[model samples]
Target: MTQINITRVLKGKYTIMIVLIIGIILYNIMNDENLTFTENIIGRMIYTYSLFRNVVSLTNYEEIEKFRSNDCSIYKNLIFGFSNKNELGIIVEHSIGYGENQEWSILDEYESLEIENIMGNRHWIEIDESGELTDGISMDMNRELHKDEVVVNFIVSKKLLENNNKLKQNLIRPVKCSTKKLCSNLYFDESKVKVVYENDNISTINKDDKAESPGIVIYVHGGGFVFGDMNTYEKVLQKHAIQLGKLNKPSIIVYIGYRKSPKWKYPIPLEDVIASISWIHSNAERLGLNPNKLVVLGDSAGGSLATSSIASCLSIKDQSKRRNNNVLSKRFHNYCKWVDHVKFLGLIYPALCQKCVTNSKLKNYKFGFLTLSSLLWFEKQYQSKYIESYFDWRSQPLLAPANILRKFPKTSIVLMKSDILYDEGRLMYETLLKLKVNAKLRIFSGFHGIYGSSWSSGGSNALEFINSEISEIMNQNN
Candidate 1:
């Protein structure tokens, strides 16, 4: 080759290396708060080397058919430089925010692959090969593209996941089933908290109870996209745990203080329940429980979570990517760790479909905060993140249980007379029965959130009502 041509080639290579190095350095410095300016600069260099290695050394797929032929799922990725079939790690390529890529480089980066939009403009990557990662772009008119954001998700192989000690430990943690009566002054280290994986982690206040004893039902409380915590269900969980203990055949009850919304949504909370169920099983011996003799319960928003969590476990294949022909082989790791088997499922007055229920709720409460607040917020942040189809009831099935009725665990549907969510629970119950899933329908005569209130603080007869159904399920399961 001519000298000029060689010089041009070398320069292009040098430029790519420089940009990668800068990107890595900036990322590290951005994360390091403890570093002085100069120290940060030094740390930046240290960070740049690792980042450079990841970008330059990773696998590349430029051909469309080759990429399409590989096994690819949101949950699988190949390990960098580890050619051995057994040693790949989960690596993801994602661009931030909501929108189509303004930069052409990303198009070139993901060329030849099909992208399928799932929820709210979030697209799933599809390649010819099951798990192929490509450096080229393909034009897919059928796919929905968000305005500025794009992400390619894939889990590393089991071997790679295991080798990364930090990642493995980070994903799973010990469950603490507190026997101590919860009060306003309850102390917990939220930082030290980790998601449980085995049933052994479930602790009950009444651990000495017998095997045939009634099962304690735990509810994971829910708030809209944002709002609520363990405190939301504090009275509900405590009242029943205490009541079950009083029955001598004292049952064990547990509630998840899961990480919450906007920041941690969807998969994070779902994973938390999976971990909690595992913990309940692991601690069954200590907690004097029968793993099979249990009922998982939730109300409203939590019901959606409980149902989704169950669906996540029952399906062996990745339901999210099941439609895409190119994603099967490349998807290595299963996102769900285990199926949470419970004797009964309980959903009381739940906002199962946000699009359906929210519109109705907005109509009646006419003058409230949500309408004005969302409008004001939208006025300020009205960037068309994605010029795509507007979300409606049919578009977002993940938020509703209408699609996942088959294989549903035995369930009891509870609702109050005046609550807005009453219709939803009733509809869901009807659907479950239509699908031939073993389910029961019950209507408690009360207002929304006011089960049978006594004169005591935070008193609600809902606990007594729910416990009765739980006892029947336990008895039947036994």
Candidate 2:
């Protein structure tokens, strides 16, 4: 060849060399980066295709779909069948299993075959028929290849599942504390005091000791009125308990753990909380607590409970009953003594909108996303002849805070910008203001339970900010 022709050929060879080098670098980068399952699979397929470019057949979407749907079992046979000309078999174990003694036979898989992922360390070949993967065994999205369909076994904490009878001991529960500054040496009487009484069933207490008091903050946790206990909110209580202790204006917090749904629906839990407050007011002296200082706080469904409890306390009927019934009078006198009873309410993303009138937030959890079984369970709990007639397709106005705004204490509410229950808090606060009930609102940048110190969404400072705000309000009221 002429010298000029030779130079041109050499230039082409050099260009090819550069391309190969660049391709190898890109492959290494993709493998090193953490990727989603789909992305990882796509990347691997691309890499594999590059190795056997000429042997692989390129097809359109329709053809690919046809192959995928047509006798997947027959395709299964093709997967084990010999590789196309120039194609080599890579021993990849499928999440699904092949027979133990049965190795997939594809024309020696062309060149090489080796297992990558297998079922339970068991030997099985992944049959890559066409381009799609078909493992004899089903695999979890996490790539947890199982021998059979059975998943690996695990257990919930026994300490967590137990009745949590000993509140003092079960301090490690989810809602036990909001901060280390909150939880320390917490305990409550394992005794029940009458709150709701066809006869008697409930307990409550309050206290404000200037020393070592986690100033009395009454909390109502949300579990859709079905499942939840004082233990449910142990963490937040513990954190505040410690904070209050540090402040010297310590608090004797009280919680009215009420009967859950199905057995007792609607006003039952509300009555229980109100009655517990009454009992606390009456028994404050015995418990060494201050009946004078109290704040009501609730979250999720419990927000509805908290709002209703305050409404009940403010009711003209409840006040009259206390006046007539000396027993009732004495029990709640300290709590009711105030021209400003129950200084403040801190509603944390309450589920106040029970009507479910197609709010935008519902789109995220439009169906049973929040709790499939729990929602069904709640329906079952309240499904009775009397309740059926009383409750309509829409939730009762009594269940919503907007309806009870006529008489409410000065309230501060914290809401999540992205929470489904955001409007509940907003509407309630707006309603309270409209009704001349003093209210403050804070919209935080996070999801629900932003104030909590656990597997929470975000905004870690929410708990501290609210606590400080509540303390300031209580001091002002005092």
Candidate 3:
């Protein structure tokens, strides 16, 4: 090689070394403010280097093909990794979001779990009046939907959905396949979700059509996006439900479910959350719930979905922006129309950014049960192969534009001072304030999560605070 070429190569090598060295400094240097008093020093240190096995279940290539659409077991044991996997700490490459880059798999009992399709959101085929594929998106405008116990399974249209859009399809390429036939056969396919309903009684039995509309609190559970379910979270779910039931007005508690990852990623799980809106709205009466009076409550990863499940659907009225894929875009537009009725949003320590390495992450990485190491793993499993997926505003709501932030419903955020996500939670609050959204924030002195496990004094305090906040918001809306 020439002398000048050798000089350039040396410069590149030095630059890479400098970047790697800086990343290690950030990873190992702990921030003092995020530390807590004496407790589990070794256990926490162990957790810092280890992750729940299910979080990385989909990272294996062969496993991805075995269980195409099943979520991993919530009980998977923990796995340890000595090397740092922080976005800046260690870099892995050669990525693609779709087609020959499939990185997903399943849980052992995923077959039964797939029954979350209580909405019949599968195999929805739409043909035109002439017995051919419908030209555009069309739902049965005059169809009647039925409710089963606490679940309702409804089929949506396919014609308007097959076409690809830049933002959504980029993360969900397989949503629509190459064959024209495959395009027509695509369904939202949320069959793998685990739905939770507080009541099984059908309102239509003897209900008055003109009776007052009941407010709906749709709760989404958080399991680091790997291991939470309505079943496992029954305690907190009941807590939120029972507290909300005491309101002066009639209310319904709907715990919505979505596909989980490393089995499902990005737009897929989000689509299930969005579909809950459509399904509930369409069958609100039978379910005795009012879609117009929705109040979303989500914790942790659920908080992220609860935020985007509404924000991403916010009025895309400017048709020109997403006109090419009008089906999903139209769903987005329509979701916004009714979304204006959303009364409030309750988020607890929501994971907001994909790439941001905040001070809290650096400080609380060891103490927080959900360490930065585990969080980065969960994020990796949740993201698409596309590099842009990391920066997508839907997943990283903290990075969203001002107008988007302004459109959020009255929101309440809960942050734990010694948690890895504390800084980002505060950032989300500050951003909302800058945009003038009616947002509220609460800071607790606990670690990352308390609700998912045994409810402690901290959990009780947090729930009480949230309950009071909900009561106030409900009173205002009333």
When summed lDDT is taken over every stretch of 10 residues in candidate 1, the lowest stretch is 73-82
TM-score for each model: 0.47, 0.50, 0.60
Q: Write the per-residue lDDT of candidate 3 for residues 362-423, one digit (tens) a residue.
A: 86445434776667877776765543422357667677667767878888898776678888
In the range 5-35, model 2's lDDT, one tens digit per residue, is: 6435323444334434543555455542333
Q: Which of 2 and 3 is ahead in lDDT?
A: 3
**Candidate 1 vs candidate 2, TM-score winner:** 2
Q: Sort by TM-score, best first: what order? A: 3, 2, 1
* Model 3, C-alpha of 390: deviation from truth (Å): 8.3
lDDT string, candidate 1, 244-296, tens digits? 44342335455654433322334334444544554445444433345556667
For each candidate, C-alpha RMSD in Å?
21.3, 24.5, 17.8
What is candidate 1's TM-score against the reference? Answer: 0.47
Ranking by lDDT: 3, 2, 1
Candidate 1 error regions (>4 Å):
1-216, 247-249, 286-288, 317-340, 357-403, 451-459
